[model samples]
Target chain A: MADFSLFSRRFDVKRVPGFASVALGVFVMLYMPVILLVVYSFNKGTNLAFWEGFSLRWYVQAYHNEAVQEAAFRSLYLALIAATLATTAATMAALATTRTKKFRGQMLIYTLINQPLMVPEIVTAVALLIFFAMIKVATGHTGMIYLIVAHTAFCIPFAYLPIRARLESMDLTLETAAADLYASPWMTFRRVTLPLMWPGIVAGLMLAFVVSLDDVVITEFVKSAGQETLPTFMLGQLRRVVTPEVNAISTVLMAVSVIFVAMFFVLTGRKN
Target chain B: MIEIRNITKVFGAGEHAVTALQEINVNIAENEFFTLLGPSGCGKTTLLRLIAGFEHPSTGSMLLAGEDISLLPPNKRPVNTVFQNYALFPHMTVAGNIAFGLEMLGRPKAEVAETVDRMLRLVRMEELKNRQTSEISGGQQQRVALARALAPQPKVLLLDEPLSALDLKLRKEMQIELKRLQSETGITFVFVTHDQEEALTMSDRIAVMNAGRIHQIGSPRQIYDHPENRFVANFIGDSNFLNAKLGNIKDDQAELEFAAGRKVTVPLHRADLSDGEVSVLIRPEHVSIAEPTGNSHELTGVIENIVYFGTDTHYHLKLASGEAFMARLQNNPSEAEKRAAGDKVAVLMDAKAIQILRD
Candidate 1:
């Protein structure tokens, strides 16, 4: 039997106030670091060992740097291409795995798709370097194509989780009913299934883009001279000098990542 | 017209094989609102899915309006189904949902708009055309589902418990609406439900199914007035069983001697009994509380319990032979006028009310 009460049966002002204090305490503990980071990105300090007063010089300096600007653009371009490719592949994988019954060795194929995420990034970097070397020997080509390929492989698993989650959570009865209503497979997918999954697909694509934007290991191994991504360029700059400009760029990247994650929640989160 | 012949569906294979339907044969006439009524796991839904082409029969073929459609996919078939959940597109507006089937058929934009408007007005939802599906109530969604299914004007419309999601009052209203819609459209509406009252009220003909097979198929009155088997009789309505043994056999009537020294006459077929044991089934409403019977069926007993309903009262009677039977009184009576619990009484029943079940 159920009490079926909309409110709590036991009402106590003292207990309610005590619970509110505990919840507020948890919030401060979790968000204090993020509150500190944004406040100090504008600090006028040469060294990130401590934050000084706020100034516009670091922001101005970061904008004027040629190498940093070029690498940032390169990273943006690579992340865009890699995210598109990876999200497309992951979307297809999610559909085939969830909508259709298992084909031969489906488990093996799934494991292989998710392998780059599980295996050490260093191993993946080394493997891609070798594989690219073999391809170069056979066809004789040298380009940033290898770096893009490596980043896409690493981002696919991250992209796949959200799409697969969305697909599994979806009620497939609508799709079957759509089919019975004379919508072909392609039309049913476009009209009924895709609209329902748009939120998940966007989340997955953004996740893959952010992962590619932050990647360092694979790009370091695969890039030739003058082809370093933003992350690899940051690694080079950090080796020479650790400046507030690095903090400025890191702050910007972290902000972008936060924005994407926030958008993900807004798009996919249920009201309840 | 739809024809299903030797339709057998088996799931799994080898050692894991399970047969879900067994050589089902049925011919559903055009424009007939048929119902497949049974309990859960009775394969009624499976039969509907097979007709909708959601499932392929493992053994036999099906024909729709003289064309062999057995190998056709669901989208290619001339049928649409309103799923148990209604299956309304959650992302689309009501108008968009209804227009989906027409759009899929490559209809012109003008014609699709005209048809969708006609259907919206038909279901009386034209004002709510722009509303999201989540904003509407269940009964409204039921109408939307019906409008969507009928907008395409498929040869047959399949409804899998379309009204099961609503409360009792709404369910009754939707039942009447569904009947009217079917009659006006003149398309085959094959409904599947377990509720007997719903099946009896709306269906033109009812097929009583059990355990993956149809028990009987007849008009609603035929099914309610005369059920073919003991299971059908028990499933359809409330009936009281009186233990009896066969006394003698005659043409078109059999003599049954009840255990409590009462004899009842019933229609006799060769399958009625030769017999070792048998039972007589009479609906509770048909049994009378008064005792003016002569040679039809008469019994003396004590009223163990009295249940006074608004329209009728039920008397639970216990015989001297330790058998309990029930009789219904058409009118309500005061406690002082009615026989109290544990009071002795006599009851009578018509011979036409008795059905003999052979064992």
Candidate 2:
């Protein structure tokens, strides 16, 4: 009884019974479907509700399917290019907003950068579709470039938020001291500002990569025919048939996102 | 040497404008340890910033070594500042921070390393050269800041209350250390501090400022001993201001009659005294408690309160005319001379020690 009491006191399990129940309910509501989908991805039978003997047939099918392979490659390539472009642009925006004194229209620029996160995703997708159609008409070029541009635009705000937060929290006295010590503005940024803000840059890049990797609506609207990313491909598969191959592909993508998020946390967590 | 001429700094414009500095003019000689001393918000820091080229004056020019540097930016100027909070680079090691300025100037790596080592030894942090700035103590970080600012050997070094963040003992230690460093390096140091004692102890000459204007500029003794006005007299040290009427104005001395009709002659430090109402200033240390000598120059007062400091004691006295004043005496008073509350004592003012000022 004493050991039980000590354990209860240490864990405080009895004090937050209502909180524990709500948390349990929320976890079940959020992750149970994902868990079920993952479990069905290993199912040997076609029925998603009832689990059959476990097998790796769907994984093998996902791996071997040429369309799946092509879509996966396209998504990976698009996410990589989009995340890089967004991270670079967001970094410049963060530095401009946080490092300098307030100028005219600074608040407007900040609001504009964050507009994509505020507006509905479908509205943004339609706007991008119209904008890219004009660009395509003018340039006569419509390939992965449209999808990359759309993804990059959507990912900018996601990248900007964390990078801006990091820049705001940074001690600006170091830069001033650098300037006082005969460093030009460019040298100070390269040596002091860049090194200190590296973690934020990496975290922003990973967040943008994860966000762009899972996007389906924007990719569907902006991408031309024969340019189906993995998410859009999965959406098409779900519309036509109910199969475990889509679940397998989703599980792989989810695993990749989880890995990137975990890496993001690790990179941003360490103190310099 | 830095020459400042009619510099004025204003923040904002029109109705919202605040005058941070007003027509400041001073010349700081080369290798001089000059201090800008004032209360907070008095624009001492603004003057220091103007000299450092961090701020440009609104109405005047600043010349450094006879070259007009009024429009030059801080990086282009031959000056560096030790910030109030030390502001050492959190990401760099002690040696790395000290070597930063030399490296910025594109010096040879071997010379940069040598200068870093020399600066580390100068601050007596040779063993902590490899330590990160955040890993060290406040005092250590302060030394690193000084070393980093001094590494490039700029013509002028600006210190913005660099010792204000340290503990009391460490502050005292650094006060002496800073004075030694200033003299040893022979660099023109323009230090800004609100601490009066620090200004007195560290600076060769002090510029006392108040309300965005420089009130007086003199040596420490001159500032303390012979302040020009009521503000300087009260700001630098403990002073007792007595209302008086000027009776006779002579070449070397003046006769001042107190409120109680008692008259005394005071040495004239300034030549602008007229024959009307005046203010007589005397330091608390100059007022001595003694028995009634039946002299008209002495003031009879009753002790109101006695504050016993370890080294000295302050006796708050109420004069016969109901005016209150303080007299500070060394603690080594004879037992017979020790007077408590309600004791009647004659306050003696040395003729030379009493200062006469205009209203």
Q: In candidate 2, how many Å is residue B115 off?
A: 1.0
After superposing candidate 1, which stretches have Cα over 4 Å from the reference? Answer: A1-40, A44-53, A102-111, A126-141, A270-272, B269-276, B290-297, B334-337
| DockQ per candidate | 0.68, 0.68
Locate the minimum summed-lDDT window of 10 residues in model 1 chain A. A5-14
Residue-pair clash count for candidate 1 = 0
lDDT of 1 at A248: 78
**lDDT of predicted model 1:** 0.85
Alpha-carbon interface RMSD of model 1? 1.7
Clashes of 2: 0
lDDT of 1 by residue, A1-272 (tens): 77756456567565765888988889999987666655666888875667788797777898898888999899999999999999999999889888997689989988987998789999988888888889988987788788788888888988888888888888889999789878999889998889888888999899999999998888888887799777888788889987778777877888888898788778667631
Error of 1 at A195 (Å): 2.4
